[model samples]
Target: MLKSSGMWWYEQFARYRYRQGMTYARKGQYHLAISRFNRALLHHPQPDEVCIARGLIYLRLGDLEAALADLDRAIALNPCNSKAYGNRGLVKAQLGDEAAALEDWRVALTHRPCYAEARYNRGLVFAHQKNYQYALDEFDLAIKANPNLAEAYLHRGNVRDELGDRFGAAKDWQLALLNDLSLDAAKKALFRTRRESHEQRLTEKLGAVLAPLDLSLQVERQGRQLNLLIQREPGTPVNYQDVAKLLQAKIVDLNLNWLERFRIIGRMGTGGMPDWDKVYQIYDNCACPPIYLSRILASLLFFMPFGIAAIVYATQVKANYAQGNYRAALTASKLIKWFYWVSLGVFSATASLVVFGVVLLLLRGESLSSIIESIRTMPSPRPYLGRPYADPHPDPSPQPSLPESTDSSAD
Candidate 1:
């Protein structure tokens, strides 16, 4: 009877420590939380709850080996712990063990039939393996389980495209967009596919016209504009006016509003030749609102206000440049130039005032050495206070807990 009472006391203390560890973990003091969890484990080594909690903390810290060990122990202690299995799958996936990860996810699903995360993860693995049909099935089930699963819809669209169902793919993509899915790869794939189709049609129409002139052309889409490269054989005489007329006719026939910003370049000869190339913009549409907005935001930086707006516009410049929007970048560069000049003037003025004040102080009663001594004698400022708590072990929450939401792992 006495031994049983002692065991009960130990379990209660261990539970108390575990609760304290969880509090520290929520507050982002990971190291202190892990220490408390270790103490809790020392009291009840076989408790699956402690193992699972510590395993999650290890995963957060990127200690895959320790996380795997604890998760594996938790699963062994209680095979029905769906949270443990799901987390083990995450660790295995991170470690590049896709086959084992899939099995763990399946086990998690078997334990809890409505496990949306496990279903989604299984679909990801299937997609990676090129099993599009299986992946589609899993994604469908995941979406059915949780209709708001944006990633599942995005991947489903990818599978539909892989299966050559363009109409279905478009529908799925629209649904994904409606759900506000932010999948960069999916968006890029859609853009590239559409651009290739447009290029193919344009090439067919331009091929016959170029054949008679003995000039070959290549068309490329760069961001919001099309670039046409006209190449001629060496020693061939080209009429710039005639070539421009022909290109302009073709662009008018196509009637694409975005193509109005096209650029045309002509080159002759194989090797380097003197003044053998001509480059010019086809249209004058420089008053684009996005570019104007960027420029205006950049100008505001000169007032020593809206510092964050300046940073945002600078980022916009880089993004536009990366997207091959040269006109937008050029316009935005004006703002950056103004900001540079204004900041230089401000810095110079501030430095001049500091120098004048120091000179005045020296001319008066203060010596440089005395100023240094006074600065040294000043008292240090107090450190910022952290979370306040008298005891390391606090009371536990009344409600039961499960694993943290799966969205964190997706990020």
Candidate 2:
């Protein structure tokens, strides 16, 4: 009776410590939680639960080896613990032991037939191995067991896609989206698939409509917008607004949502003249600074003999004028006109200097040559008395002998 009472007391204390550990764990105080778990284990009551809890904490902390050890001990303490097997499978998966992980998951399912998580994990393993049929089966079972499992649907969709059932895959993805509205990946997949389908149908429908026109047209879907590109033939007349209205009518007939806008681009023939209105619009809405074209033209002038600054400035002026910024256009035109006159004046001055310098060189060539010859023929001075210096070039003339000193007595 005394021993039973002692065991009961130890069990109660162990349970209290385990509760404290769980509280710490909930608060993300992992070290404190682990300490309490260790104390709970030391009391030796309900060791399986304590081991499983510590193992999960270790797993959360990314200590795979510790997690494996604790989970193994938990399984040994209670072999029927499905949760221990499931968690061990996760650790094995993290360790890259896929085969072992799959086996663990299977064992877990055997212990608890309704284990949806284990079934889902097994499906993931099959998917990794490229066994699409098996993966699909497992995912289906998992879904049946837990209809609200969004990940199962998401992964099943992928497997279905791999099996070449695009419609089935799309259905699964839609189901996943409906199950979990916050799943961004599912949303993206559904959007992409639906967009591709819409683009294909639109292309076929637009192709039929453009057949009689004998013009090459392309239909592109960009998000909520539909872009129509019409290749313009030389000497062929096309009204862009009319074409836009026609395409919009066709799109409406197809029962698609009214596109946010229609982008009609007319493709000019090779080396053909560009539409001035289009060019103006392009420059008017450009994010570049107003002087961007000016700088580019100035850079080009270094390589080319002609300056293009005036032309670029004129283009900007025309663009601004067409956009109803008449004041800005006038100011730009005046600035460019002044710049052109200044440039012409500078060019004239530079050309005059170059011409004058050339003429001077031509006229003074003989005089300069004669002066250089005189300088070459001039004689060098003799070295000073009593100071010997080395001569770079010896003179060809003989040196005169010094007069012999007559007064030996004076010496």
Candidate 3:
């Protein structure tokens, strides 16, 4: 009723109330936030905004039924509202419907390819199901979407630990702490990961491996230095230098990641730290390849097919590296760079169209809403990566096709 020529006063009030609700929610005052959202709903023409806001508060308050109802209303009001779908996916996951949750997240990503929270939630479920590999992949996508997401790093570290990539896990825990200083869980996990016991275990493994050569190892300087000696049995035919070189090669073939953490200074007839350079070579060979996360982000913003390709290759670089498939990781890294350039070219064309397309639409008497819808439904880039992942849900009643996913980082 309070409309002006250029703006709707009701919309202004709705936005004001929505900001107030968000402030309250951030302060953990969910009930007050819900009240503000309800008031905003009364004046809002597009009720989905209020519905999604209220639904999120209800979800935070553990009122699953209320949250589900609000989210469903939001979806009904605006099927293209990716925020509603992502939140509903969380609700579905909590309600013991993991498959449904996955489906919702897939649809959400179809709408918004860079939805970090949806990816994070999906990763959590996968981790819970013991699908560590899939969980790690999803976490990679979440990190790519929002690099400062500490929880994603923390959980990804857990998945890496489960997969026995303790080195990578420790690195992730460190990154989590770097991003969120107050995250006590990350602090504790990192401390546990780097305890002295790890050094002690490494020392024992090295000693065991070197015993058969009539050689002894003494771990010194707090496990950073190694002292070596040969048991000079009289009339022994073995050449000490040849034995040392052979041991070094055998250590390299051991493929122990922790070996690089120490300087194996030879002593008593064996060469110095240079003899152990093979271990460092092993670390260098197995290192993960380039991620190209930022390039993939640009691709996602403009064209999803290239984004998909970039994401797959970027993820492969890490996954393959973790499994010691350095060749494959490098191959994927090269492929990602190629896709990055292709994506850039596509984005250039898309940007050119966007700058001029708006003018053409407006000149033809098209409204902003219709223009947005046209962009959302823009002929699916099927030849590249196919339509958004919104297949069909298992609801008894038929539902309409969904739009793109929503980025929680933006929300």
Candidate 4:
């Protein structure tokens, strides 16, 4: 057999294996890629490409330490390798070393200014830190480099919103929606900005009757402030009672964690075995229970009467307003305010009553001890029977029988 050229032999063996490893990595056959990369590494001991390929394979498999080792060796072997730094930065980011990751990305950018991946990753790091301006700038550059990048526009829109540029943010979000309709952030923006041609009835009514121009222009008639934004939608009718019911439903999601914990504790409390106490102790030691249920109870106690008063007042106010009885509605609103104060007073008094009763019980256990003593010291009662124990003298022989009084009239 003819002797093969050294370069050709290396190409046939080492290069072929490295290319095969890359193919395997692309197919997500991480283990096979690792094996192929190792074989290639043995043949081409100092090859930066082989080292980088192995690093990428390790990174894909979540083997951060192995990825870092390969990346470090690759960087050492070729100090000017911007791709190695970029790959290493991604691994560092996955490990939560933002500082190290940013540094690597920065180095990658300095070496290869057009590295879009590094720039985008660095921008995300900035966004994670809430440094939105810098994040926005980086995203701007990323978009310039790759104009079709929908994610850059989305994040830039978020950053703009964070910086109080609602119009700009809306524009960006709209563009993002056009690019990718799946994004909920963009959809929310579109919803909020959407408006119809129908005139607000409250605005028209308030405008016609009220005075001082601006004061009369509000969607709601709440004194002189003229704040219209607080009013609910005009025509798409919603039952306030049903809204309150739905609000209670939505509130359940907020307390689910504590509810689950309480359920567990409640179940334990019902068990016959004393082991529940140990479980409770362990849970208490590990995590303090949320006071949300207590807060909910306290808040209900705090606001229930006022809530009922408002509900009662609302029907009267709406009915009066509808009947063109503005004065009655105004009076009803004042009464509502008065009821709020009264409810506050009642809640305070009720709480005081509870505290006072608790203190009384703590001091003297229902006053039973004193009551028992008073009863013990009192004279005993004689039993009633057929036979009497004592009798008083007959009432002095009945004072001589009274003369026939009826004869006085005849005399």
Candidate 5:
């Protein structure tokens, strides 16, 4: 017979059977595991642990009645078993007896005060009953017991939101994601709250500007910024530049949590509505796009036409610069560097292809030598003029010859 471990060589049948039952349970063979647990209980002195393990399996399989029976028997065997009470609470909760489930949780908590799982379960029940204050307390206790509990933070955030503590809710959601990055619900909650606050401020401030113009402001989110489209009568005359300037001047004093850019589109000009990009920031250093001297110098040195043209355009377009057009400014300022990199990229690719072809040709030449050698080594490839490389077709005409030496024997 083969033993599984050194301890298994002398282990008793009851403990062995219990371990096998646990192994089968871990492998998700519920029915086979139940039979193994039954067999182990017949020989084991303590049946509470076995019953608790089997009950958990039954609970996972959705057999509430069997799980409840097993848990009740486990509690009878050991009145101090907090696990039995806690899991029985879950079964009762599923059975639609909220009052009895709460009672079970109370007993479980009394048996083990620091049980984080029990506290979390109680928080869910409290939240469901709309007792948000009690739910918040339970979740706080659970988090205190186990600081890394992401679900506890998540539910606590919901309770805080229900209690009108939005700041606390946002903080809780942030903490939940810090503990578990996979909590996308928490991540979305945080993003939504931030966007709401930002858009609310924008609407109030920007909405006031549109009041006197007989226009309505429609704000649509475009990534991290807001796109403001001024809605008006089809034939109404409106200058895109004037509206953009008005929006920019009024938005300078506003405070925001997230938005930094606002794109304004007013009435159609000679062309359609122009997209006016203005970036607003609280900090003085970020109020305008930065102008780096090194960038201009590098552009002028490596790429000539783009650097010179961009610098000239940047200087000529005073209104464009004053309007804080981010994209145009980047193009003017970074054109030289962009061109230098693009040219270098193209040259490097060509050089790489050439190098690869050279290496391939060398390898091909080496293989050709093997073929040539093999042909020469064959029995007799051809009756050539004692040289394998000689031309097979000999010239029939007499070749040009040097003058014969005067002392040659004429035989």
Candidate 6:
């Protein structure tokens, strides 16, 4: 009984020494921790926990090889030690052996399912792989295990943003900031995502309105020269001859109207590519308002190959229909313009499919085919201007009544 009591006392003394070593290690006193750990080992010849404490201290001191050796001895003595696996995984990750790190983390998780740090670390590995969905799932589990985990929230928010779930990203970032007010990363991410989302919505609204920009513009270039023509509206009559004369003189002076007014709008560098951008702006803002539709079509032609001409014309023709310029709209129908019609018919089916796909993608359900079909079915106009024809024999009008009689005889 006395010997057993002495053994117990020795065990307590060894544990005390091990704890002192850990405390010193935590305070960055590596030499003191090492000295104490050595003393503990002398007192208890084979103490696995003391060995673990010494190994962790060695790790904290950056003696990774010694730390790993101690950890191996500790694990061999206590085969079920979960913390041993976790520490090893940390070392492996530091060494950039991600697979080994992952394996160790999985083993640790198998022993302790609620290990928040392990889960967070594994999630980081997945994130580095760009497997955002997997990373997010791991982060979600970590957060569930430890709701106060600000790091988990931040990482999850980053993954959400990458997945294009901006709202979810912002929510996670906001939550992270709320829990850990000092986490500057969380705060910055929240602000950035919110601003990006706001800007994205603004762009979408503008995109919807400006999708028709491909309709009202035209561009043509002859060797070493480019010309952009915006057709004037027939309905809104202007001095065509005067404008033509002005254009001729400007051409002679090599000073087009767009070049003069371009400076008023923005500098050339604002749009990067001047020729392409200048043409689009003119189509959108020029006074040849009806011709605006044609200008946009011409710009589309200039950008894409000649194959896009039909699609651009279709878009312009549809815009014209929307504006009630039925004559110009009808003239735009490729079938009525037999020259363009014959050109289209000559294309192979493969080319036709390509053009059709491009048109559908650009139009995005604008009903171009139906508009063109309707315009084609309408009869060609005669050389005359008159009110839109209703039914020639209109519904019978009420018979006209005679004026009232004097009625003096009746009175």
lDDT of each: 0.77, 0.78, 0.78, 0.65, 0.77, 0.65
Per-residue error for 28 in candidate 3, Å, reads: 2.6
Clashing pairs in 5: none
Q: Candidate 1 on 343-395: residue-level lDDT in tens? A: 65766788899789878888998999987787789899989898787877877
**lDDT by residue for model 4 (208-261), tens:** 432322222223222222222212222333333332233223323223222212
lDDT (tens digit, per residue) of candidate 6 on 1-411: 245777788877987888888898888898999899988986674567777778877787788888888878887887777788888787777778999989888998999999988898899999999988889888988998999999999999999889989888889988898789999999888877665564455344323332343212233432233344333232433343333333334333332333322111111222333322231221222221133334334434434333355565566676876776544454555322443334445545558787787687557765766767766899987887878878878678788899998757763
List the pairs of residues colliding in candidate 1.
Answer: none
Question: Model 3 RMSD to the real structure?
Answer: 32.1
TM-score of each model, paired residue for residue = 0.53, 0.56, 0.49, 0.45, 0.56, 0.49
Worst 10 residues of 5 by lDDT: 280-289
Model 6, stretches more than 4 Å misplaced? 1-3, 43-46, 201-411
Worst 10-residue lDDT window, candidate 2: 276-285
lDDT of 3 by residue, 105-218 (tens): 988899999999999999999999999999999999999999999999999999999998989998999999899999899888887778645545655666676666656655
The lDDT-based order of candidates, best leading, equals 3, 2, 5, 1, 6, 4
**Which of 3 and 4 is the better model by TM-score?**
3
- Higher-ranked by lDDT: 5 or 6: 5
- List of clashing residue pairs for candidate 4: none
TM-score: model 5 vs. ground truth:
0.56
Error of 6 at 89 (Å): 0.8
Candidate 4 overall lDDT versus native: 0.65
